[model samples]
Target chain A: MLIPHPLLGPRDAQEFTYLGDAALLARPDGMAEGALGAFIDYVYLRDNPAGVHRELWFHEQGDRSWLVVTRNTVTHEIIDAQLARDVALARKGAVA
Target chain B: MRFSGFRVIKEALTGHKGWQPLWRNPDPKPAYDYVIVGGGGHGLATAYYLANTFRKARIAVLEKGWLGSGNIGRNTTIIRSNYGLPGNQPFYEFSMKLWEGLEQEFNFNAMVSQRGILNLIHTDAQRDAYRRRGNAMLFSGADAELLDRDRVRDMCPWLNFDNARFPIKGGLMQRRAGTARHDGVAWGYARGADRAGVDLIQNCEVTGFRIEEGRIRGVETSRGYIAAAKVGVAVAGSTSRVMEKAGLRLPIESHVLQAFVSEGLKPLIPGVITFGAGHFYVSQSDKGGLVFGGDIDGYNSYAQRGNMPVIEDVIEGGMALMPMIGRARLLRVWGGIMDMSMDGSPIIDRTPVEGLYLNAGWCYGGFKATPASGYSFAHLLATDTPHETARHFRLDRFARGHVIDEKGMGAQPNLH
Candidate 1:
């Protein structure tokens, strides 16, 4: 599969390491109320949907940037690809 | 009717019209004491065990499609209990025992060949790991044999023993573990369950669960709403989607695991063999076809197909292990959706939703664990207690830091 990276051009999926579900970036606080429960859900439970899924793929052999590739799980069609760092920073700014 | 030599002869004499259907294609009833979603091997086996062993009244299995249309029919069919972890060894060994007696107990030819399975060791550390795994197998009352390099050479002399990349050192063999007729297991269990007064409803996809106050009332299916006191789900790869209808998210990801079979040639591979340097396993079928598979697609996907990269990678592993296989013609390639769990093991436990039990996350190992998973899940549904062998396979094990990480790959579903 050819994964289109935000920085680098389209690259083969073999060059990237797959880490499922981009929701992983929204890790809950480890020192808050019901932290254990939230952490458990974060680390364990997954919304493994059959439709569109935002997943984290590290272009380890190429740009070394983690890309949040929004792809359809059933069809394998990539709808969008963006730098995961940019998405995380945007989320932080929104929280601020 | 019981299948026998006399029956076959009599049918032959009577123009071969006396044979009966394997299992009844019954319609779903309005209510049942127990309702199982997914008519795959585990679901059918669960229904059979619930009726025959647990003596549960009013049991029904609802299948989204025809039986054995899922991973039950799409696997390399290798069965072994050579696990190293305390939580997994005994459980898989229990499954091995059930596999041994499945054909006789269910009165069907599942082709439970006990040719044995060998996991090759390429490194000194791998040898130590195999030694520990073999010891764990022995501790679980399962057969295990640690074979030296010469012994492995004796078993399969054609293997690439002199390969510089993966030198043959030793292997761990389980004489009782081997392949079976994958689809035959499903048919046998379905027939057994049907004969025992359990309903097998096909084409009845479960759309959602009917929850009343905290307990599960029944399931909303493609056919219609069917009421039941308890509902068990064993939809191998569709575990996540099916459970989501009840607002439950599982610690499971769906990944495509591809299997390949070569064109029929002369008898080659004697038994199941696995490469130690990479993730690839192979066994020759009775049809003289080499049945083999390797790692998943390395991504979360509900698609029952894989990319070409994994296919090329698997063939590379095969060629590295046995250069002789390069001449063989690739005949068929198929993929099965694997319900990969975080710990690389399975989860057969009660969910937070009362009366809604789960038997999922079998990953690549689900096909081999068919019988035991059914039996254990039946025990759970009948008595509301975890089976002794599978007590460690709890849904909360990940949260409690009790993950059954046999490969030590740590939380990555794709890697597992």
Candidate 2:
């Protein structure tokens, strides 16, 4: 599988370490009233859809930035790719 | 029907007309005492155990596809009880015992061959690890033998011993562990369940669960709504998706694990053999095709297919293990979605929701654990208590800091 990185050019999937669903980035704070439960969900529960999925892939063999790749699970078609930090910042901005 | 030599002879003499269908194809009933979604090996085996052993009446197994169309038919078909963890060793050993008597109990041929399984040791540290594992297997009432390099060479001299990077040091062999026909297991269990008057409904996909007042009333399937007192989900890879419909999130990830079979050749491999330093295990089928697989695709997806990188990775392992197999032509390659749990162990316990039970997170070990998984899961559904051997497979184990991290890979599913 060729993953198009936001910074690097198209790279092979073997060059990246797969960290599951991109939703893991929005980690819940560990020191809130319901933080334990929220942290459990953040660390464990996943959508794990059969169709399109947004997942985190670390370019361990290339540039070190984590990329959030939107790809179809069934067809393995990459729809888009971007830096995961950017996606996290965008999520925060939208929330703000 | 009882299958025997006489039955075969009678059928042969009577133009082969006396044979009946292995299991009936029935439609969904409006209500049942218990409904099990997913008619794969585990589901079928669970239904069979519930009906036969627990004497449960009005049981139904609903499958979205034809039975055995899922991972039940898409595994390497190796069976062993060589785990090192206390929480895992007993459960798998129980499963190995069930596999021993499955064919006789079900009155069907599952080809439960107990030839042996040899896990090669490549280094001194690896040998020490295998020694500990072999001792653990022995302690769990399973037979194990620590074979030295000479014994391994005596068993199979064709392995790359001299020039390989990971030189063979020794191996841990379990004589009672071997391979079986993957599809035959599903067929046998389905037949057993059907013979016990349990309904086997195919092409019935469960779209949602009918939970009322914090209790599961039944399930809403593609066929229609079916009411049941209890619902047990044994879907292998689709556990998360199916449970999500009931508003529950599982601590599981779906990853694609690819399997390959080589063209039929002269019988080469004596029994199941796994490379110590690499992620390659191979066994020769009755038809002489080498069945093998390695690690998962290292991604979370529900896709039942994999890419070329893992294929190359697996082939490299095979080459490193046995140079003689480098010329073998590949027959076919396929993938199955694995319910990789965070701890790399399975979860077979009751969910937080009332009247709903779960049996999933088998990872690459599901095929070997089919019989015990079903038996223990049936115990849970019938008695509302975890089976004695499966007491450690609790959903809240991770929350309680009791993760059964068998591989010691932390919470990484891919590494496990």
Candidate 3:
């Protein structure tokens, strides 16, 4: 599988380390109220769908950037890839 | 008819004309006392134990496809009770006891061979861990032995013991653990369930659940609606998808695990040998082909295939342990989906939805847990109570902060 990195072009999947669902990026504050429940869902639960999935992959062997890759889990076809920092900043901006 | 040497002789004399189909292709009934989804090994075992052991009646096993088409027929077929944790050791030990008497109880030849297994130790710290695990196995009423390097060498001398980086120090051996015929176990249980008047319905896919208020009344299927008082789901790979039909979300993720076999050779591997330093485990099949597998692909996928990286990683581990294996040509490779749970353990308890029970999250260990999983799930579905050995497999364990982290990898489904 070739992961199309935003900066590195199409890199082999072996170079990236998989951290599972992109939902891990929206980590809840451990010090807040109802934080335990939030963290439980954030850590344990996942929408493990059989179709398209947005997941986090670390380019550990190459650029060392976290990329949010939108790919179909069934066919292993990558649709889009971008730096996770940009996606996180955009999500926060949209929320604000 | 029951299988025996006398029967074999009789059939041989009769030109093999007296043999019949292993199970009947029964049509779905309008209603049953209990309905089991997923006619794989666990499902058929559940139905088998429900009628024969629990003495329940009117049970129907609905299958999306034919029986033994899932992970039941896709695993490496190793059965052992070498667990260390309290939450898992007792349960697996009970399953090992069940495996001891399975063939005679079901009257089918599953080739239940207790040929022993060896987990090679490559470091001093790993040796201590195996010692603790061996003691735990003994405490759980299972046999275990700590063999030194010389003993391990006597058992299998072809190992790369003088390697510079990771040498074989010793091994943990379980004398009474080995492999069984994966497909035979499924067929035996299906035959026993069918003969005991349980309907074995095939090509019947469960589409939705007929829940009245908060309780399940029956399941809507591709065939038709079949009313059932209680429902038990034993679909490991499709656990999340099937439970979602009942308006439920599980703390489970599906990942694909691959297995491989090489060209047939002479008797090479004695029993099962696992490389403690890596994720590789191997054994030679009865047909002389070397069967082996390693870690699951570290991602969420429903595709029943894995990528090249995991394959390379597994073969590298094998080569590191035994350099002689590099000469054998790879013959076949396949993948089976795993319902990896949060804590690396399984869940065999009742769901919050009334009249619904769950038996999933077996991950890579589903094949070994088939008999006891069936027995425990049947006990729960029959008496509405958790089995003694399986009480810790609750769905709320993760929420209650009582997760059974067997591998000490906290809350990571992929790592487990």
Best model per lDDT: 3
Model 2 agreement with the true structure over A1-96: per-residue lDDT tens digits: 899887778988889998888888888878889998887777766778888999999999988889999998878898899999899999999989
Model 1: chain B TM-score vs. truth? 0.99
lDDT (Cα, tens digit) per residue for candidate 1, span B294-387: 8999898888899999999999999999988999999999988999999999999999989999999998999888989999999999999999
DockQ of every model listed? 0.88, 0.73, 0.78
TM-score-better candidate, 1 vs 2: 1
- Model 3 earns a TM-score of 0.99
Candidate 3 retains true contacts at a fraction of 0.69
**Taking the tens digit of each residue's C-alpha lDDT, what string does model 3 give over B121-159?**
989999999999999999999999999999999989999
* TM-score pick, better of 2 and 3: 3
Best by DockQ: 1
Error of 1 at B123 (Å): 1.4
Native-to-model Cα distance after best TM-score fit, residue B94 in candidate 3, in Å: 0.3
Worst 10 residues of 3 chain A by lDDT: A39-48
TM-score of chain B of each: 0.99, 0.99, 0.99
Give the DockQ of candidate 1.
0.88
